[model samples]
Target: MRKEETVDYHIKVVWHAISRMYNQGGAMKGITASSGFVLLNIDQDEGTPATKIAPLLGMESRSLTRMLKTMEETGLIYRERDTEDKRSVRIYLTEAGKKQRDFSRKAVIFFNDKVREAVSPKKLEAFFDVMTTIDNVIEENKNLDQKIQLIENE
Candidate 1:
């Protein structure tokens, strides 16, 4: 199939476009799309656990550690020892972090609102259904590479 016709190509292209848009919007706030995402995932009121943020953002702990350090240095976030679990750390947003998070939220909502206005509700529902199906297919094929390797040995 042509690259333009491939599902993965379209998904990747659209995601990159979205990322670029977010990065542009975040630039004004002195944040990148990634940092904005991290800020939003952190709970401002109660603080989120250090371990929990990585899974929420689908990031590796090492990458998050570096990002968190940068955020701390920038005065966007602070780390506190978990009171109940002394070994664990909790991440809380500073006032600056809250402002950035709000910006990210509004940007996301604006994008969604524009998309919703352009697409019919029925079409939007169909799109969501297709995305869900794609996720399920991926889960079902989790062992596909191993199975393919086994077949290749036969």
Candidate 2:
């Protein structure tokens, strides 16, 4: 096979493995991954405004709002009106959210172990670096029209 075809095949295989792991895992249910990720990200940057969280996650504000509402109903997160900015709400994980975060951490460790068992440490590290680079490249290539649309929709 040509080099490009080989690269595409490997990318598909990696994505499939990741999808399967997330879907089958107890802690990281496929449907809830986005909410979990947003929760974890908010935990890392506590007190971040809700508006900012959606953009950082590359998701729409409406979708994030729905996710937040679900999480709040589940007792996983709490939103408080920002003291300095009454119109803006800040997100914070509740006790249950912390527990979810712990579960996600363990799930990621389990997933990493599975990967390590299948691939060498060096290869895993390389794969991680390559994926990060690809993400960065995509972010950097955002066009003016896309940016404008994102802002307009917000």
Candidate 3:
């Protein structure tokens, strides 16, 4: 296969692996693919705002609000008015949420260990570098949509 084809195939494989790991619950049932889980893992203690999490998760604020509300209803997380800024709401994991976070951490570790066992350290390092480069390029190109729209109006 060509280099580009190889890259595309590998990207798809990686995406599938991540989707399977997150979307498919292992021992725990009822857990679904959610930005809330990722946010909980990243900010176990720190309370993050809904606006802040939306950008980080590459989701719209409205979508995030709905997700948060669902998670809150599930008793996974809770929101409160920020002490410093009453207008801003901050999110934190409840006791149940913390247990879910722990389960997520263990599942991630297991999946990562399996991947590590399959790939050599050198290959893994190179893969990490390539993924980082791809992330950077995507972030840089995010503004291209606006540029293209501006040119189209000319």
| Per-prediction backbone clash count | 0, 0, 0
lDDT of 1: 0.92
Residue 131 error, candidate 1, Å: 1.5
lDDT of 2 by residue, 21-88 (tens): 66566344323667656866785445679888988887899999889899889888899999999999
Reference-based lDDT, each prediction = 0.92, 0.77, 0.76
Q: Which regions in candidate 3 have their CA more than 4 angstroms from the true location?
A: 1-9, 146-154
Please say which candidate is ahead in TM-score: 1 or 3. Answer: 1
Residue pairs with colliding backbones in model 3 are: none
Clashing pairs in 2: none
| Winner of 2 and 3 under TM-score | 3
The sequence of per-residue lDDT tens digits that candidate 1 reaches over residues 1-154 is: 8999987798899989999999998887899989988998998799999999998987899999999999999999999999999999999999988998999899989999999999999999999998899879878998989999999999
* Residue pair clashes in candidate 1: none
TM-score of 3: 0.78
- TM-score-wise, the better of 1 and 2 is 1
Model 3: per-residue Cα lDDT over 1-154, one tens digit each? 6765786688988778786768777335456656435545447777787668877766777887788888888888888898999999888888877778777777777878999999999999998899899889878998978989999999
Q: Which stretches of candidate 2 lie over 4 Å from their true place?
A: 1-17, 27-31, 144-154
Q: Residue 4 in candidate 1 has what lDDT? A: 100
